[model samples]
Target: MTNKPKPVIGITSGDLNGIGIELIIKAFSDQRLLDFCTPVIFASNKVVNFYRKTVTESSFSFYHTREFDKINPKQVTIFNCWDEEVNITPGVLNETGGRYAVASLQAAIEAFKEKKIDGLVTAPLHKSNVQSESFSYTGHTPFLKDSFGAPDVVMMLCADNMRVALVTEHISVSAIAQHITAEAILSKLNIINSSLQKDFGISKPRIAVLGLNPHAGDEGLVGNEEQTIIAPAIKQAKNNGILAFGPYSADAFFARGQYEKFDAVLAMYHDQGLIPFKSLAVGEGVNFTAGLELVRTSPDHGVAFDIAGKDRADAGSFIQSIFFCADVINQRSEYADQRSNPMRKIAPDVVSRLADEKIEE
Candidate 1:
């Protein structure tokens, strides 16, 4: 029997007080999105309806489905997880909203694990609220990694055609120095390389590694981490036959569109990469969790509590998340097809696979 077209995407409604509902409403408003993949929202009909009334009374219709088999892409399909009545108050954080948001995420994750959904495109969830309601985790990336038992996971934020992968995430600036070791850097680089080749379809991805210090430690004049830690990691990555280069200065590297030269940049810290990345591609950036067992993507921006219900939230990033998810899904499908095809022959030494010894030792 032929396999059915499984392009169903699960979208988790973020915090009720945030722009999650607004963006979801706006993104699905476009009928063209249905042409690419079937979107299954893991939310409540009551919540979505109330959001529509508060934000845009466009008279759009949504079909409620309890199961994935009942999804119809031609119309908006919502999986009702909440059986009780919900009060949809935009721009207000409450216990009910927090619980509901966590429920939606859990439902989507279960569906993905069951193979009912092809990929997941999360809206935005308030970290504090989610932690209070559900199990405490670092962020979406770590949550997904733990959920799927993915050993190595990378958080990549992309905007304006520039992509950056975070080496150390969800930690303070002072803690980043201790976290920046040669082993950690090399491991992240491996994840980035595999993700680019498999999910991104980049045959030979040239990746740039950013230095942790100013002016790349001025060649050890300022700090020796560049020479001792970062440089050695890059050298090891190069020896592994990965096209990895540099420990470029974080400040001057982004100027003159230098980031465009490489496929992706490995940032040593969170703000060091995200500040410039967001500055260039704030509303349009898509935050992608690479090296996951399943495809997962989200809007680069966070919950905009200030303008949640004002109809002022831009859906650009949310829309970009959907598009990026679709793109990655297609890339993965194509790669799988190529691998299964008998006529296709992959080069033996093209991409080096890291052994257990390399990863552990």
Candidate 2:
């Protein structure tokens, strides 16, 4: 049998004024990454060269193409999205940056629809800068959900062994309590459990649920979200054959390193989970969107405008995101194959007969 072809990965060039392009160039500078997947960057040659000059000694090279059919698998492919003359001011926020960022994303989304790419690894884009009437959303998760028609998606942060999935993302803290319902929590738990099994190859994922309130509402004295909202969700998850346990105090849980005991942790809101994840991830974390047919991962850190053009951005997380995307693509394919033709156990008598037949042969 022959080996499978390398997966085609689509990468979006985020915020021209930020460090998105720099990170992409730095990550792909190492030719060794090409052995795993064929990378197709959705940006014009001009935009890439603007930052390529700033990376000190970047050896990144690419094949420029206007048609998807002409993508070269041997080297990186720069799928030119546009050919307009625009000023690129690094470390500055402007409409030009936002407009072109959207263009790149739309181009990548089109490629995804055509099935030209197996997975996506997006560079960070500023939430405020990318906001326009036509593309108004908090961040990539919701935008992607609408683009792909996925009912809902979970924002999961991954670093080594620790995985944290958020039930609520990019919402105001004042409104967080209102959204933490039993149904919502249960939905996130289901997605995390399924992603762990299918994407991460966990046969039975053990999920730890974090509470919305401090000290887990102190058993209902500080708040009742744990008892009323979170507890019911955990109970229902267990009933549904998911081994989910929690309503654990967010402080004590991380303070004691309890996240290592489970496959994934479900946090009630954004900062509640991300703060701890970023602190512990030590620049090795990446953001993965679960509960979608398409696989998407991004660098855990955002567009660092302060350090933009300084060549100070670390590409570790960006590189890891690519690795994560490829791993998930391969895992999902293997999962589909196994489910399509599962192995059957032979009975004792059948095994004996098969053994005797083999011996006679």
**Cα distance off (Å), candidate 1, residue 30:** 0.9
The residue pairs in collision within model 2 are none
lDDT of 1 by residue, 72-136 (tens): 86877899988788777677777666777788888999999898888999888777767762558
| Candidate 2 per-residue lDDT over residues 259-355, each given as its tens digit | 9999999999999999999999999998999998889999998889999999999999999999999999999987887687664222545878999
Task: Supply candidate 1's per-residue lDDT for 191.
Answer: 94
| Candidate 1 stretches greater than 4 Å from native | 1-6, 57-59, 342-361
Candidate 2 at 229: error in angstroms? 1.1
lDDT of 2 at 320: 98
TM-score, per-candidate, Cα-based: 0.91, 0.94
